[model samples]
Target: MSALSLYALFTGRKPPSVKYKYYRKYFIIYAASMSSFAVHTVFICFFYVINIPILSVINVFSVSVWALALRENYYGRHSNAIFLACAEISIHAVLATAYLGWSSGFQFYLWPAACLATINPRLGVRLSSAIGFGCIVLFILLKTVVDDGLYNFDFRKYADFFYVFNGIIAGISLIFGICSIRVINERQEEKLTDLATKDELTNLFNRRYINSYLSEYEPDADLENRPYCIVLGDLDYFKKVNDTLGHYAGDDVLIDVSRYLKQRFRSSDVVCRWGGEEFLFLLKDTSLRQAHDLVEKICRDIPDNIHVCSSQRIRITMSFGIAASTGVSQHEQLIKVADENLYQAKKQGRNCVVSSEITG
Candidate 1:
């Protein structure tokens, strides 16, 4: 519907899609209503009563064309838009039918033109309606009132009412579009802010963000089991791949590693980029053993895909250290113990998980 509105507003220009759907049907119906008013009203003075046979044919044809456009506009359809469109169509259909009876459907087409005001909360709808309504009024005066050359339009006596009606339509489109644009812009900003805190390379929370969040997280000292476990893992000899293949290949390694962690861990587990060549996982509501074992599984599963250096299948491994939040006063305290264990894992042999609980 937005696309249709955008196109109509731009006089048949194409619009970009955040997502695509057909509200074009509604827009086309709207345009048809306005355009039809122009066509139908021109003849109202001659007949004073619409040709029902012709109107029936035109209405039926209009409905069919709208259905086709409706289907296409549905590519990005929302239920709300559908409901609104249906309501607008129903109202316009009834009014159009009545206009046919009075042979003045064109004169009243302004009513349906005003319906565009409801298309959105933007001021544009109301503005368009006003423009259209003004056109209708001018159409009425030029053809009917000025006929005797006395500058006497029949509706000139009630021009105030018509002007007010146009003003209302203008206000409606403007408010709706403004509100909708503001909300859409706000959402886009929020998504952008969220992206800023993420690691584009690994699709994980960046270490800076993790640290900031951790700094804000208050620990519970009285709990028997820890609230969470922090695991630090470093890829063993990661520099060798970069040194051999290139930075691009090294990026793939990081991506694969991140995916491996995400696949194995629960949704609640948070994986973060813990500086270059290292990663961190915060497992919520986990014990020391569970944390250590989980990290061990992740360390073991790092894919050594053939794409590493020579486009040949290769294996990759990392060493992990685990520490529970239990008895840890600060976020760094937990990381400190985890780092110690990680160093121990590296010393024992690469590609293993080391835990202080197991060492002593």
Candidate 2:
């Protein structure tokens, strides 16, 4: 049963562990280790290796204890189960090697265990360092004492069998541990990429992401002949709201506006928080006049009453500037023209839409 479970891990079918999702890889490792122990138990029982079956029984007992620890949320009441399991298994390997002789290749298991312990974030630095140093010291001592009569042992022809089997198990464990680490790193990279591109406040694409998108877009490469427009807008009197009510109120207003903007625009349109109280919209297959008309409608539909704190009722308004591809050669030029029109809207009293095409 244990051997079958171990095989599941090699095939990427991990057992379910809701409390220890991150440590679930170690659960697979534990299953594999238990299976290895079970094999040793069968081998020793068949050949009658003196006192070895007793040690294998103890190792099985250790696996049971670790399994209980995992279930009980032990190991500091968190998913540090892998670290604890690695340390326990490494210690067991050292003891088994000392008793069975280094010829059994049990010491080979220590290397992979130490590697896992050191790399795992769940394992404390001091604990990892101690285990790493202990493994190194034990390895050195084993190498030094192997030639002496005190350490030398022969299991007759069975020695070769034990050595080969142990080596294969150790190699498998190392590969599994390395692959787990790679999976963890890849997940972290994806999370970081999400955080980097998204705005913390409004959950919209930030200026950095939209700018990159615009920079990568090739105007001449539009084989489908789709037109696009840039609509740059900013909240009217947003700074006053921040100063009078508080930044929290300002945040509430931004959140409210962002939600409406998301609902109002097409999914193909890229709406971003350009910075501060400003937002930029990239509308595909839309003209500057259409963009302007859309913004004007959105400005009209904005609720007159927004709750800013429990007692304060605030009305929010936005000014927009539109620019289309027909009048501009590149996004940079379009953005500059749109920004200038945005300035014109601000100058023409707060809640209004201005376009470069109108100004031109």
Candidate 3:
């Protein structure tokens, strides 16, 4: 199966949307709970075989504690569930080390508890750090106070095996917790980048992102220094639409225009909303005549009936000004020339295309 499918199976579903604040926490806690349940179930059998009645009974209770934590997390009582898990792991580690001795390596489970304390966001950094430090102190106490096994059993001869087993499980738990934190951080970074670069309403490139693109753009040297064109477009009488029909209707009109522009342009071309009622388009590898023709066709083919609401439809038109990279290399120069042409189009009439080479 693919990695994405595996991730879905592990998390019990596809990743939740970024808007959900607690999704990452929920996933981490749920996975921990299930893993704890399975691990304790193994301990229950191991203790029974070794004839350690007290430890076996304790592990049976540990399995039930993990089950209860899982149910609490499912119901969104995340703080309570996390507390239960931390308390159980800490207690179990101390008890196991006291009985079997530190050579058995049960105290290593305390390290994962330290890591988890720091990961949980609801626990402030100071408190989490303190808890982590407490785990270290507890580990020292286990080493100094419990020098050897208390129970005289035949299984005590296999201390090395038990040590290796507990160490591996604790290491796996630590790796899992760290990987969960990494996934959450990467997802949050993606969400922040999208918010910075995209217009929320139009879902198109915003003015700031478009300017950055233009500033960094370079023409292909192998293509004989092919030129690009910039088109400045303004919706005619857009303010009048807002004055007559509410701002909501005006927003619907902008959304419709944005959708049309996105569909009409080539994938290589850049389309952006340059503030209220104005748009900017960058047509790569196009000449003056080609850019003019394209804009004229777009103006002619615009849909007349734009639906703003269930009962309302309106007709709208736009004016476009095109500037080709004939003598200029800088984006600022091209934009200034396009803006000047846009002014001329507004002066002559609305709903027309004006370029350096032709006017229509």
Candidate 4:
């Protein structure tokens, strides 16, 4: 399996994953630093065998990055931690290349730094690009100006081995970092989708989703005469609750009513918080009689009182109007028809269900 796929599988699907941008970035950088610490510790053993003291010093710098990651995590200053990590990696790359000669393959470290700086949305593209350019310039200058006398070990003797090793590590780091970016992007997309489709107050499907669903949903005409029904529901005396107990209590009532309505409807049914103190449902593959029966069941099942703040129990009721599309192609007309039935229900008396086919 590819490194990205393996890493994803190893991590598994963590639902409702870390959503905070700063915290997510912090986690990625912390993980990178920890991995660096492990890799550098392994290199420390290799350097000890070769008696390369400067390379040992570079490994110490990697340890320092780990320490800084811990400190930044403690302080909850995650952005600074990422910046410091990028700087740490860059400096280690420059110094290692300068002291051990470019053949030590230290220049490969710059790729991860560039990847981190580029992918992190918090960091500016132009600024990271400039930093990457500087690293490239620094590497070239080190190769040009640094003499062989400064080098402790001649890595050129095992250049192919060192090159392959460095390439594998660099490739792994780049792949892991890119996968992390993709994970964050996916989380953000999920979050945005929720915000766009969900009602802020009731946490039910909002008017936007309902409107979109109505426009897109096409049922098979051969199944039945009327394949769907739209039920319009409004809380009876909702304004009185708001005026008497305050809007907060009214909000509580709406949320409670939403829960009750959700339980009454089937999973295939589309239930939405249509507006303030109002809800809408689209019952799929339901006849007008079935729709009316479902709406009546909901009206009867909904509790008469909702307990809100300060243990104050407030009484409320809902009025329902249901209309089914009878061989009619237009869904918009069903909504209008349902709304009119709802008005008729209120006119007759609140806390009742009205349907054009059943009531009229």
Top candidate on lDDT is 3
lDDT of 3 at 314: 53
Report RMSD for candidate 1. 11.0
Q: After superposition, how far is residue 217 of candidate 3 from its true place, in Å?
A: 3.2
User: Model 3 off-target regions past 4 Å?
Assistant: 1-19, 41-49, 60-68, 71-80, 102-105, 133-148, 152-165, 218-226, 239-246, 304-313, 326-330, 357-360
**Steric clashes per prediction:** 37, 0, 0, 0
The superposed Cα distance between candidate 4 and the true structure at residue 323, in angstroms, equals 1.4
Candidate 2 local lDDT, 96-182, one digit each (tens): 667667777777878887786787676689987777777877777766775222333445346568779888878888898788778
lDDT of 1 by residue, 33-147 (tens): 3443443344243223333344445454544444443443333343333334433443443343233322222233333334443343334666645644554564465346433
Segments in model 2 whose C-alpha atoms lie over 4 Å from true places:
1-53, 56-84, 87-183, 220-224, 304-313, 358-360
Candidate 1 segments exceeding 4 Å error: 1-153, 156-168, 220-226, 304-313, 357-360
**TM-score: model 2 vs. ground truth:** 0.61
lDDT of each: 0.58, 0.71, 0.81, 0.74
Tens-digit per-residue lDDT, 1-360, candidate 4: 456543532342221232455566656665676676677787777776778866787887777776676456434565666677778888877777677666667678788887666654457889877876776677677778873426745555765676577768877887887888899789999989999999988889999899988886744542355468889999888888898888887787788888878877899888999988889998988988988887887787665444555445555778999887766556677788899999999998888999974221
The best-first sequence of candidates by TM-score reads 4, 3, 2, 1
After superposition on all C-alphas, the RMSD of every candidate to the true structure, in Å, is 11.0, 8.3, 6.6, 7.6
lDDT of 3 at 350: 76
